[model samples]
Target: MSAPGLLRTERARLTALYGSLLLLAGGGLVALVYVLVGQGLYASVSGVVRTVSPAYRLPVPGETVDVGRSPEPARTMAPGETPTPEELKGYAFTQDLSDAVTDATRHRLLMYSLLALAVFAVLSIWLAWWMAGRVLRPVGVITETARRLSGENLHQRISLDAPPGELKELADTFDAMLGRMEHLVSAQRRFAANAAHELRTPLAVQRAAAEIGLAGEPSPQKVARIRERLIGVADSSEHLVESLLLLAVSQEGLEPGSTGPVDLAALAAAELAADPPHALTVVRTLAPLTVTGDRALLGHLVRNLLTNAVRHNRAGGRIVVETSSDGELAVSNTGPVIGPADVPRLLEPFRRRAERQHTAGEGAGLGLSIVAAIARAHGASLAAEANAEPEGGLTVRVRFPLPDGQGAVRGAPGSKIG
Candidate 1:
């Protein structure tokens, strides 16, 4: 009932069907034998002729009696008359010849009957094979259909119309499974469409308000208020736009090619050199960890984490950046302590728990969401917890699992691994 019982190949199934026909064909020969014995084939012809002769007139020595349904001849003993052998010969109508021919006929009839049986055996075998092939033809079609289905093409169906009652049922079941998968794919596409639309509406309104404020000058206090609010809106919109784009791209997949082992100490020094001269001092403790991913993307991951640390730190307070590897990679930072309840939800989109409110930036709440998504896209894990120091500060860490034999880590096995 399941599209020909896991018939992995066409030849195997054809062989099975042919074998069944061979098994049933023997019965056809048995039916032919029954007809041969039913047509009075057991009686001997000579015995039959002897029994009939006595019922008719019998001849005495040298005398003949007419066996016709006429008057008998006059008494022959008075005249001592003897019948001529010509009359006796005339009375014998192929009697001995009939006996001889019956024996030969019996042998000839038996030989012909056996020859007929042989012909029927051959005919039945050929017919059986032909019939069996006809019965399994639909099953062969279903096998080909299954072979062609794949992720690239999920919209395929089987058409069933044939004997072998179970196979038809199997095809119906396959069609049902495909239907459910198609429905799920459709729902995902719709959800993505709706989310993009909802995010765009607010971004458009915020940009309009900023443009209106910029049209005319106002008092110093009013001007500062407008400027600050516009900057805040601009920042929020930028964060949202970037988050949505990253989420979309990550869902599609990112190629993990063209990444080489990066020197963590060199990278940290470069970041420090590039930073603006803010009160937040850059502190780095780096190790020689050889981790690999998309060079551009991994660099972005490091830059974003460092920026978050610096932005959230108290003025003149230190922002620590560290990198090392344990069979792979670990990057960490320290800042104001993040509460336990907010740690897990921080990475989710648009989620900043109550403890994280009143922060410096009017963030669209996507900083850690980007980090998490990027980590997921690569084969890594990004985690957040309270810093080690009792004078509390938050520490964000990202861990990457080592590849086989410590080659560069990548997206998937044998795929683009940087």
Candidate 2:
């Protein structure tokens, strides 16, 4: 089954379609009445004239039928039954009967034409409504498009969906216009994102070198000096480049073509085991659950959730990772409670809390934005909140739908990857 079409504007077409249907139905009904009653009247009158009325076969002496014209039998019976020539001769007949029938037929025909015209008159009213509807259909479409349209959609056109006659073609044209608009907008977004990312690498290297140079003898006095000088350059550079790169990646968007079955729990555990040990206590119920998605993207999504959790945590707080097959995975960490006001903006790039002042790292506030991008790419859902534990702090969660169609999250595949 296919999904129903989206109507950019449809009221006009609907009105026209209804009007036309009504016209067609009414015209048909009138025509039907004419056919039925006219045939009945003709049959009844013909039968009465033929059966009850007497037709004169004799003429007054010396008088001839057909009004002095030679008498002719318009119709005769079978050979043995036909009146003889002598019998018809000198017979006077009333020519008025045939004339009467002719006159009657004419009157009835006139009446039929008039009644039919009346029916057509009513039909005309409906026809006017129908025509008006058709003419206005395009206008209605244009109006609806205008209502929903914005400057961003300037290139979008309007057309009918399933329109009769030229309307279908019109609709196709409209869709084509919108296709162009989408293409242009997407291209612009992609260009900006790419340009920003390209500028980030050099800035990053410079910042890192600056940090290493000022680190060895750093103290309140020395650190204050470095921070006031080289740190400023690194911070500003990192902030600018990161913000730009984030914007670029978001615009380029995630391509989900890499979807395949990947074991998320295994990935999460492996990530936890890498390099620098976690400073905060970590707890997890590892599952062998698998899901279909881009592995690299999902890995990044998970890392962002972890990084956010880590960055926001109070000293020595605990982080918990939970996995399940209700098509969900969640990670929660203890950190400073984020105020409700800041929660909504957390996922947007370059949107940091106003009270925040961490000069140690090059976080251009793109972490959550990347998380959001990765989530969107893989049809996953992610959320963040303060842990509800009485000694609460921040908690972030990333969820992935389970593979094999809604089964429980698997655990202990029994074999270990070396």
**Highest-TM-score candidate:** 2
With a 3 Å backbone cut-off (N, CA, C), the pairs that clash in candidate 1 are none
- Model 1 spans with C-alpha error above 4 angstroms: 1-232, 256-258, 276-283, 314-318, 325-341, 355-360, 386-393, 401-418
Best by lDDT: 2
lDDT of 1 by residue, 1-418 (tens): 3656646545445555665565455445444553453234334454465456532323565553444443555333324555446445534643654547666776776677667756756775576556656666666777788798775566888867665478787787777877777665754565456456546755675677667755586667766877787676667667667767876665554675655666545665676689753876666667765555665566666666666566556656766666655523333344556666667766665555443343446455556667667767666766666555543455666666664576554432110000
Error of 2 at 275 (Å): 5.6
- Candidate 2, residue 265: the lDDT equals 85
| lDDT string, candidate 2, 1-418, tens digits | 2223422234334545665676677667766766675666645655554344333354334433332233554343443464545445422222345446656876776677667767766766576657766666676775698688775766666646554666666767667877777876765575457446535644665576567746676567766665566556666675566555654554465555656887878878877877233678888887666878778767776676676667666678777776655545676766655565567566665556554353555355667777777666666666655445464655555565566556654332211000
| Candidate 2 TM-score, true structure as reference | 0.56
Weakest lDDT window of 10 consecutive positions for candidate 2: 409-418
Report the poorest 10 consecutive residues by lDDT, candidate 1.
409-418
Deviation in Å, model 2, residue 185 alpha carbon: 11
